[model samples]
Target: MRKFLALLMLLMISMNSTAGLVNAEADDPVLTSEAAVLMDTQSGAILFGKNAEVKMYPASLTKIATAIYAIETASLDEIVDVSEEIEKIDGTRVYLNPGEQVSLRKLIQGMLINSGNDASLAIAIHLDGSMDTYSKNINEFLKTNIGVEDTHFVNPHGLFDENHYTTAKDLGLILNYAMNNPDFREIFGTKQLEWDGESWDTTILSHHRMLKGEIPYEGVTGGKTGFVDQSKQTLATTADNGKLKLTAILLKSEYKRKIYEDTIKLFDYGFAAFKSSQIRKGETFTSGNLKFKASEDLLVTEPVEKGKRIVDKDGILRIQNGKGEIIQAIELKPLIGKKPEAKTETAPEPKQSGLLSVNTILGVVVLVGAAGVWMVNRKQKKSRRFRSR
Candidate 1:
C-alpha cells in the first residue's frame, strides 16, 4: 500500500510537470480590448488573440467586401453615373453629388480611402442596379470565398444596420483574403488619393501613427480604419519583417488611440513572440510519389521559407501532420530564390546518344567487321598453337 501510494503521487507529479510545460509555451498575455487577433498571413497560425470569436460591428471595414465584389464583377475603367439613391446615404460622403460620373476605380478609392458611404451606394447601384442586390451578392461572396461564416451585410457601406456584424477572427480572415488581391491591397493601403477634383485622406492619422512615422514598425504595409458611435473604433493592419508577414485586427475599442495601440501591440507581440518557418515550397513538401504528365519519378527538392520562432527555449514546439499525427524530426531551412538553371538540371535529353549511335548503319558495320576479323584471327592462332603442342 505504501509503494502504490508513492507510485500514484509520482505519476501525478509527472502529469503536472507536462501540463506546466504546455502552459509555459502557450502563455500569451491578454490585452485590454473587446476583441483582437494576430495571425500569420501565410500559414494562418494564430499567435495571440482575445475574444477573437466574439461577433462585433465591423463599421467601414465592410468596404473590404464591397471593394472585392466590385473589383471582381466590374472593370476598373468602366464608367458609372452617380444616382439619386447614392446621394441619400447618411454618413461619410466622398462629395459625389448625384449626376456626377466616375470610373469604378475612382469609386473604389472613394469607398476605401475616404470611407465614402455615398460612394458605397454608387458602387452598389452600379454593380447590381440596387443596394439590395449588391448586399445579397456581397454576403454570398463573403460566405463562399472569404469563409466569413459569422458576418452578414445589410448594406455595402458598414452603417449601424443590425444585420452587419463580424467577429475579430472573421474580419482578420477577410482582410487576409483581401490583401491577396492586388487591387484591393493597393486601394486599402492608400493614405491619400486625389481624383476627379476630389481629394481624400484618412481621418485618424496619429491613431495609425506608424503610417506617419510616429511609431517604429518595420514593413508597415497600409491598412483600413473604422469608427462609429456604436462600434467605437476598429482597425486592420498588415506588417512584414522580411521574414514573416502578420495581419492584426482590433474591434470595438473606446478610443482611436486604443485601437492603434492595441494594433501596434498585437503586431509587436506577433513579431517578438513567434517565428514563421516554411517547411516546403513549389513541388516540395508533398507526401508520397508525384507523377507528371511527361515524366516518371520526377526529381524533387525541398524549399523552405525562413521560419519565425514562436516560442522561447522555455516553451515547447509541436508539429503535426494533416492527420493530426505529430511529425517528429521536422527540419526547416530558409528558402532561397530559385536558381535560374534548377529546372533544366535533370531534364531528359532529347534522345539517348548511345542508343542513337548504335542505330547508325556505319557505326554498326564498323563494330561488326572489327569483331568478325578478331574472331577469325583468334581461331587461326588457336589452331596453329594446338597443332604445335
Candidate 2:
C-alpha cells in the first residue's frame, strides 16, 4: 500500500509539472501587430502566430524574391544596362541614370540594400525581356517550387500595388528559402552596401537591433526591415540563444521601437521555453538504409552527427547531460541471406565428385574379369594339349 501510494504521488507530481509547463507557455503575452509569427528555421515548426495568414503589403520585402530569381537566371558577372522603361518605374531608386551599366552582382546589391526599384526593373528587363514576363516567372517559381501561395507580385520592387501582397507566414517562407541561397542571404543580411562609387546603408539603424544588443536580446544573426505607410514598421529577424534558433516576423507595428520590443519578447520567450535538439544527422539517417548489391542493410562505416532535445513547452531550458552534448550516433549492421529453416539439425550432404562415377567403376571391373577368363581359357587349352601328347 505504501509503495502504491508512492508511485501515485510521483505520477501526480509529473502531471503537475507538465501542466505547469504548458500553462506557462499558454499564458505568454501576445505581441500587438496586424500579423506576427515565430518559427524554428531548422525544423520548419511554427512556435507562435497571430493573423499569420492575412495578406498585407510587403514593401521592400518583395526584393527577396526578385533577388532570388535574378541570381538564378543570370550570372553575377553579366553586365546590365539600365533601360528607359526601368528608370520610369515609381518607388525607391538607386539613382541609376538611363543607359548606366552595372554588373548583375551590383544590381542585386542595389535592389536589396537600396530597395532600388530601378535595379529591380533592370534585372527583370534583362532576364525576361520585360517586367510582365519576369512577374509571371516569379509567380510560377513561387507556386511550383517555393510553395508560397499567399504571395503575388505585379512588380519586382515591393511598391504598393493592388496586386502586390503576402502574408507573414508566406513572407517567412520566402525569406527562409532566400536565406538558403548564399548570395541572397549575404546581401539581405548586409547592413551597408557599396559599389560603383555609390553606397546604401540600412535606414533602420541595425537590420536586427534586438540581436545587436541595442535591445538586450541575444542570437540575432541577421534579417531584413520593411516600411511603408501601409506596411508600417515591419521586421523579420533570426536569433540564436545557444540552443534554439528562432525566426520572428512582425508587421504593421506603430514604430521601430515597438517592432524591436515585440521581437525581443518573442525571442526571449522562445529561448526560455525551448531548445534545439538535432534528432538525426543527414548521413546517420541515410546510412541505415544503404544497401550493398541486393543486401537489405550495411554497416555504418562512416561517422555521423546525431542530435535532439528535451525541450520545455516554450522551447527553452536546454537540458544538459553533463557534457553539454545533445547528439549521438547509432551504428547499423549488415543483413545477409534469410535465416536457415528451424529443427532440421542434419548438415547438408557433400557435393558429388565428377572424376569417378558408379558406371565407370563397374565398366573397369567387367573388363578385368573378362581378361582373367581369357587367361584361364588359354591355360586349360595348354593342359589338354600336354595330356593328348
Candidate 3:
C-alpha cells in the first residue's frame, strides 16, 4: 500500500513538472540561429533552448571539447613533438614544422585562441597515437565526465565532417563543464597570445568578437568560434554577472552577425529573467512520509520572481517559477540517519509530592559528597602537620 501511494505521488510530480516547463516556454526569446541553448553555469539548468537537442554540425566547437579533454587528461607543461600530419591540415594553421617541440599548453592556446587546426592535430596525435583512438576516447570522456549526450567528434578541430556533430545543449554542457576547471578557463578566455612558432610569428587573437570587445557585451568571459561550409557559423560563449554565470551555444547561423546578435539576446534574457539559488547540504525535503536531503551544496536556477521547491516521492527536487512553471529538477539522496530533533528526549515534569525531584535530589547528593571530601582533606592535613612538628 505504501508503494502504491509513492507511485501515485511520483506520477503527480511528473505531471506538474511538465506543465511548468510548457508554461515557461512562452517567454523564451526567439532566435535566428538554427539551434541555440542558454544554460546556467552554476546550476546546469537550461534557461532557454530552441532545437537544442537536434543533431547539428558543431564545426569548430569540437575544439572546445578537445581543449578540455586534453587539459584534464594530461599535464599542460608536457612537451609535445609536432607531427608531419599538421602540414597536411587544410584549414587554420599555427605553421608547425615537422618535429617541432612545443608545450601542450601552447598548443591548446593556439587551438582555442587562434582556431589552429594544425595545433589541434598536434595535440590529438600527442595525446593518442591517431585520430581514430582520439575520437573514441573523447566520445567516452564527454559522456562519462561532462554528461553530454548526442555529441560525437571525428576530429580535434571543428572542421566539416558529416560524422562530426553535437547539439547546442551538449555544447552548452561542455562549456559549463570546462569553465569549472581553472586551467581550461584561463586558456579559453585568452584574447591574444604571442606566437613564436617555427613558421608563424605574430600575435594571435580570439576570433570571437564579443570576447575580444570587438562587439561589446557586459560580463563576457570566454568564447569559441567555428565555421565551415557545412556548419555556417557556430559559437560558444560564457559570461558571469555578480549574480549568475551563464553558457550560451549558438549553432548554424547563416551570418556571423546574426549568431553574435542571438548570443547577446540570449545572455540578456538569461540575466534579466533568472537568478541562482542554492540547496544547502543536509537541507531536508519531504513528500508524504518520504524524506530526502541534499548531500552537498547544490545550485539551482530560478526566475527572478522567486520559485517553490517541490519534492517528489522519489526524492527529485523541482524548482518552480512564480507561475508554477518548472525550471530545474535535482535528485536528492535519501536521508541516512534519524534527524537531530528526533533524538531529543523531553524531561517529565517534577512530581507535586514533598520529595525532591530526581534532578534536585542528584544535585543535593553531589554537593554533600563534595563537602565530605573537603572535611576529610582538612582532617588529614591537620594530622600530618601535628606529626611533622
Candidate 4:
C-alpha cells in the first residue's frame, strides 16, 4: 500500500513537470537562429529553447569544448614546439611559427581570445600528438566528461568540416561546463590578452563585441563568436545580474546582427522570468532518523512562489515548481551525527597524594620546618643548661 502511494506520487510529479516545462517555453522569444537556448548557468535549468536539440553546425563555438578539454587534459605550463600542422591551419592564425616554443596556456589563450586555428593545432599536437588521436579522445572527453550528446567533433578548431557539428543546446552544455572551471572561465571572459609570442607581437582582442564593450549590455560578462560560410554565425554569451547568471547559445543565425539580438533578448527574458534561489549550506531536511543537509549552498532559478521542495525516502530533495515539474534534485547528504567519538575506555588516572595539591604540600612543608626549628632550639637550650651545670 505504501509502495502504491509512493508510485502514485511520482506519477503525479512527472505529469506536473511535463506541463510546467511545456508551459514555460510557450512564450519563448522568436529567434532568428536555426537553433538557440537560454539556461541558468548556476542551476543548469533550461529556461527557454527553440530547436535547441536540432542538429546544426556549431562553427568555432567548438573551441569552448576544446579549450576546456585542453585545460583538464594537458599541462598549462607545458611548452609546446609549434609543428608543421600549425603552419597548415587555414582560417585564423596567431602567427605561430614552426619550431618555435610556446606554453600550452598561451596557445589556449590565442585559440580562445583570437580564435587562432594555429593555436588549436599546436595544443592538439602537444596533448595527443596527432589530430586523429586528438579527435577520438576529445569526442570521448566531451561525451564522457562534459556529458553532452547529439554532437560530434572532427577538429579542435571550429572550421567547416562536414563531420564537425554540434547543436545549440550542446554548445550551451559545453559553455556551461567550461564556465565552471576557473581557468577556462578566466580565459573565456578575457576581453583582451597580450600575445607576445615568437612571431606575434600584438595584443589579441576578443571578437565578442559585448565583452569588449563594442556592444553594451548591462550584465554581459563574457562571450565567444564564430563564423563560416555554411554556419553563418554562432555565439555563446554569458550574463549575470546579482543572483542570476545565464548562458545563451545561438547557432546558424542568419546574420551577425540576428545572433546578438537573439542573445540579448534571451538574456532579458531569463533575468525577467527567473531568479536564483539559494538554499544555504547545512540546511537540514529529515526522513525518519536520516537527517540531511545541503553540503554547500544550493541554487535554482524559477519564477517566484512556484517552487516546491520534495524530500524522498532516499534523502534526495527534488525541488519542483508549483506546476509539478522537478527543476533541480539536490543529493541531500545524509547527516548522521558523528558517533559520539567512540567512547574509548581510557583508564582513570592514578590518584595522587593529598599532599600533592599545592596548599596541602605547602602546609606539610611548613609544619616540618617548624618542628625542625623547635627541636634545634630545645637541643641548644639543653646544651646550654648542661654547660651551666
Show how many residue pairs clash in every candidate, following the order shown.
Answer: 8, 14, 2, 2
Sort by TM-score, best first: what order?
Answer: 3, 4, 1, 2
Please report the candidate that would top TM-score against the real structure. 3
Candidate 4 ranges beyond 4 A from true positions: 1-27, 281-296, 310-326, 331-389
Local accuracy of candidate 3 as per-residue lDDT tens digits, 89-139 = 988888888999999999999999999999999999999989999999999
Off by over 4 Å in 1: 1-27, 198-207, 281-389
Worst 10 residues of 1 by lDDT: 294-303
Where's the lowest-lDDT run of ten residues in candidate 2? Answer: 298-307
Error of 3 at 253 (Å): 0.4
Q: Determine which window of 10 residues in candidate 4 has minimal summed lDDT.
A: 21-30
Q: What would you estimate as the lDDT of candidate 4?
A: 0.86
Worst 10 residues of 3 by lDDT: 21-30
**Which candidate tops lDDT?**
3
lDDT of each: 0.72, 0.70, 0.91, 0.86
Between prediction 1 and prediction 2, which has the larger lDDT? 1
lDDT digits (tens) for residues 30-137 of candidate 2: 686778887765555556677889998877778878888888777999998878897578876777777878899888887776667888888888888876888899
TM-score of each: 0.65, 0.64, 0.79, 0.73
The positional error of residue 237 in candidate 2, measured at the CA in angstroms, is 1.6
lDDT of 1 by residue, 304-350 (tens): 22232222222222343223322222232222355665565677767
Q: What is candidate 3's CA lDDT for residue 353?
A: 61
